[model samples]
Target: MILLFQQPELPKDQPATETQQYGFELSDFLSENIWYLLIFVLVTALVIFDYYRRKKEKNNGN
Candidate 1:
């Protein structure tokens, strides 16, 4: 399993610089707006379900 976890070797002449070696970390976009998106999706799903339920009931009653 060591081969699976092995670190790739850089070129012999091309040494990795500090800035190149360690780039800036990326922020988690989903984690930031997770709650807002979750609420939005939940509300949308509920609205769609309610719409379909009402439509079905109306059709059945007719």
Candidate 2:
């Protein structure tokens, strides 16, 4: 039908607002546990570096 093909009218009411609540607060958490955070980062970096080094040595057959 022609009526079915016609575009619908926009609503008179305004769109609803949204509230964002959840997110990471890294600054706060890091400041509270600076030493632990530093140790964690250092250990993670060392592990990643060792992994790549071992992979390179293996690929070179040495």
Candidate 3:
């Protein structure tokens, strides 16, 4: 498995740069934006679920 913070080597044909030399993984992204993205997803899911639930309730005349 690849490590999140592992710094990958520069491409053989390309010159080494500070940014490109270091590759990021999915865990790194989530760790950095966990609070923001996680909350956004959770809130979005709740809103969508609630919308469908309310629609069903209305259709059922409740």
Top candidate (lDDT): 3
At residue 35, candidate 3 shows an lDDT of 97
Q: For model 1, how does the per-residue alpha-carbon lDDT over 1-62 read when each residue is reduced to its tens digit?
A: 87998779965788777656776323455777789899999999999999999999999999
Better lDDT candidate (1, 2): 1
lDDT of 2 by residue, 1-62 (tens): 89998879866876544322334466767788999989999999999999999999999995
Order by TM-score, highest first: 1, 3, 2
Per-residue lDDT value at 52 in model 2: 100
- Alpha-carbon runs more than 4 Å astray in model 1: 1-27
lDDT of 1: 0.83
TM-score of each: 0.55, 0.53, 0.54
Residue 41, model 3, lDDT? 96
After superposing candidate 3, which stretches have Cα over 4 Å from the reference? Answer: 1-14, 17-25
Which lDDT values do the candidates have, in the order given? 0.83, 0.82, 0.86
Number of clashes in every candidate structure?
0, 0, 0
On lDDT, the stronger of 1 and 3 is 3
